[model samples]
Structures are given as C-alpha cells and as structure tokens.
Target: MAEISAVKEAWEIRQRFKPEIWFSAPGAKHYENRYYANHHHSFVNISVTGEACACRCDHCNGKLLQSMVGTPTPLEMRRVVDQLLDKDCRGILVSGGANSQGEVPLLAFMDSIAYASQKGLKVLVHSGIISRETALGLKAAGVDQVLLDVIGDQDTIHQVYHLNQRPEDYLRAMLFCREADLNIAPHVVIGLHYGQIRGEMKALEMIREAWPETIVLVILTPSCGTAMEGLQPPNLADVGEVIAKARLTNPNIPITLGCARPSGQYKRQVEILAVDCGVNGMAYPDEETVIYARSKGLQTMFTEECCSLIARNV
Candidate 1:
C-alpha cells in the first residue's frame, strides 16, 4: 500500500510538470502493433569491436553485439554510415564491447563518427568507462550523446563486470563527459547484481549529482548463453519503486524506460507501472500500455528514434 501511495504521489508530481508521455521504437529491433509500426530502417546500431569484448560482463557476455552491424575499422565504419545514409537512416548508435578496463575502443573510429554526424546522422555512442581525451574527441566529433552505464556499487562492478574499478570510477567518467561538455545519458540497470537491487538507488543519486541530459532506467533481462540466463528478474514492485523514486527525485529530468528489459507479462506490467510512475518516455513499450496512458488522459506521442533521443528535444 505504501508503494502504491508512492507511485500515486510520483504521478501527481509528474502531472504538475509534464502531462505528455512519449513512446519510441528504434530501428534496432522490429516492432509493430495496433497502435503503430516501427520504421524498419530509420535508426540503426553499429558494433566497433564486432563480437569481441574484454570484460564479457556476466549478463551480456558479448552476445548482444552479435545483432549490431560490425564496423571494427574506421574505413568500415565510414562505409556502413554511407550505406545507412542510402537507406534513409536518420541516426546511428555506435557501440562496441568494452575492454577489461571497461572502455569501448571508440577513439579509433572518431573520424567515421564525425563523418556520420556531418552527414546529418544523430550519433549516440555507448562509452563504457571513458577517458577525458576520448570524451573530448567525441565532443569534437559533434556526437549527439554519450550513453554511459553508471553502476553505483563497487561489488557489482567487480563481480558482474569483472573490473577493478569502483563506483567513484564511474562517477569520474561522468565528470569527464561533463568537462568535455558532452550530452550525457546515464543508464542504470535495475537488478544488475544477479536480480538483486544492489545499487540502483545509489546509481540514481549519482545521476542526480551529475545532472545529465537524461536518465535511462533499464531492467535486467536475463539473456540466454550468459551467466544470468536462469536467474529471475527483479521483483515488479521493486521495479516500480525505483521508477517512482527516480521520478520523485528528479521531478523535471526526462526519465525513460530504456529498451533493455524483460519480455511478456513482465514487460507489460513494467510498462504500465512506468506510465503510472510518470516516465517522460519509453522504448519499445507494450501496446496495451499505450492504451492505458490514453485512458488516464495523458497525451501520447510516438517516435521512430531511440528513446534517449527524447532528451535532444528537451
């Protein structure tokens, strides 16, 4: 009952500020429903490291990279960008496997990224633990946003990510992006510690301190062939609590339910809770959730771009 009241309060706070909600379906995956169909080629994802990853995090183990377009070299990245442009692609997410030190090898492909940005592509980079030089380079390349996973617990960092880094290290990376004046979109994965809510709230607090352009919350979706394949996702009530607290803490920031989450009924419930909790946007939202938002008298809008791109307009 207390959790229910908290969600209600959060919704009220949201209504006081922004009454509109946005649904996004990026081209990374095919999505269609009664409400809308995704633009199959509007946006795309690229992997600079191919199927390689040094960290090989327990939850992902580089399997997610298999679905992305492989552009390991600068030349290949340029070629892929040109191909995407011909397909009428409006944006591209340039991501790759992180190294043992949790850094994506993005510096080598800066020129290609710049070329894509120059060609009017909104470029979003998944920078794992970034350095100042790389941050500055990305900013110079005119990248649209730098997406960084902000883990707030050192134990999760060491155990799941297999890194020697601490929570402060993640904070420092955000500071680097801030120094470079790059638009930061920090992603906090709920139940990253093997379906346990270890550091998500702390992660949200860190994001509040960093003052990013947007805050993205993704629930853990145990993937096959990974260490967490057999694990259950976090409790639905807990997921709602985190989303509600995120809304309450950052009343005006654009909080989004990102694309990485569980499917089926769990996905449906989370999407409904997100709408009730007052998230500004959602990625790949369930069809019924869209109808529910309308039933509650909330204005709705749909976009074919990544949910994080909503911050660009804000």
Candidate 2:
C-alpha cells in the first residue's frame, strides 16, 4: 500500500509540473510500431575499443560492443565520422569497453572527437570510471554529455564488474565530470546486482550529490553468453518502487527510462509504470503504453534521439 501511494503521489507531482511525456527510439536499435516508426539515420554509436573489454563484466562480457561501429584507432574513428556525415548523421555516442581500471580509454581519441564535434555532431561519451585528465579532455573536445553508470555497492563493483574499486570510486568519476562542467547523465541499473535491489537507493543519493543533468534508469537484461544469462530481472513491484523513488527524489530532474531493459510483456508493463511514476521520457516504448499514456491525459511526444538528450530537445 505504501508503494502504491508513493507511485500515485509521484504521478500527481509530475502532473502539477507538466502534462507531457516523450518517447524516444534512437538509431542504436531498430524500432517500429503502430504509433511511431524510427528512421533515425541521424544518430549512431561508435566503439573505440572494438570488441575488447578488460573488465568483461558478468552482465555484458563485451557482448554489447559488438553492435556498435568499430573504430579502434583515431584515424578509423575520423573515417567513420566522415562516413556518418555523408549519411546525414547528426549525433554519435562514443563508447567502448572499459579497461582493467574500469575506464573507457577515450583520451587517445580526443582529437577525432573534437573533429566530429567541430563537424556539427553531438557527441555523448559513456565514460566508465573516468579520470580527471580524461574528463577534462572530453570537455575540451566539446562533448555534449558524459554518461556514467553509478554503482553504490562495493561488492557489485568488485564481483560483478571485476573492478578493484569501491563505490566511492564511481562517485569520484561523477565528481570529475562535474568539475569539468560537463553535462552528466547518470544511469542506475535496476537489478544490477544479479537481479536484486542492492545499493540502488545509495546510488540515487550519490547522483543527487553530483547534481546530474538527467537520471537514466535501465534494467539488467541478461545476455545469452554472460554469467547471468538465465537470471530473471527484478520483479514489477521492485522496478516500480525504484522508479517512483527516483521521481520523488528529484522532482524536477528529467528522469528517463533508457534503452536497456527486457522486452515483451515486461517491457509493456515497465513502460506503463514509468508513465505512472512520472518519468519524463522513455526509449522504444511499446505501442500500447503510448496509448496508455494518452489515456492518462499526457501529451505524448516522439523523438528519434537518445532519451538522455531530451533536455536539449534533440
């Protein structure tokens, strides 16, 4: 009952501020439905490390990098950017596998990143446990935003991510980005700790301290080859509680249901709960959820950009 009331209160709070919600379908994934079809040729994702990851975390094991365009060298990255420009791509997410120290090693490609930015492309970097130098370099390259996954449990950091670091280390990365005056989008993965809710609230607290521009919440979708391949995701009630708490914690922040998560009925239910929890936007929403949002009197808007870019109206 308390959880129910909290969700209702969150929804009410959202209604008081705005009567609209956004659904995004970035080009990272191919999506089409009755309500909206995404032909987002203007956005793309690039991997600087190709298919390599020193961490090889339990949930991903570098499998996620396979989908991105591989540009392992500075010249290759520049070449890809040129090709994207020819294709009329306006934005790119520069990400790659994390190293042993849990960093994405993006400093080496700063010149290429700047070149892309100068060429009129919005750049967002997924920085894993960044350093001060790398943070400043990203800022210098004119990167529009830095995305970090804030983990609040030391065990999750050590065991799941195979990082010889503490929760404070993740917090320090956020602080580095903050000090660089970069737009920080912190992602809190629900069920990150093997389908259980551990340290998520603490993660949220740390995000509040960092003054993030947006909070992106994603679910742990078990991959086939990873250690957690068969694990079930967090239950609906748990997902709802976290979403509601996130909205309540930052009433004015643009919280988004990001692109990662399970599909099928779970996806539909999660999207509905996200709207009820007053999430500002969602990525690749189910067609039924779009209707559900409209029935609740929300003025639905659609976009082909990443949900994290909602604040900039990309």
Model 1 C-alpha RMSD to native: 1.1
Q: Which pairs of residues collide in model 2?
A: none
Among residues 3 or more apart in sequence or in different chains, the pairs in candidate 1 whose N, CA or C atoms overlap within 3 Å are: none
lDDT of 2 by residue, 55-104 (tens): 99999999999999999999999999999999888799999999999999
lDDT tens readout by residue for model 1, 29-117: 99999988977779999999999999989999998999999998999999999999999999999999998899999989999999999
TM-score of each: 0.98, 0.97
Rate residue 71 of model 2 by lDDT: 97
lDDT of 1: 0.90
On a 0 to 100 scale, what is the lDDT of residue 104 in model 1?
97
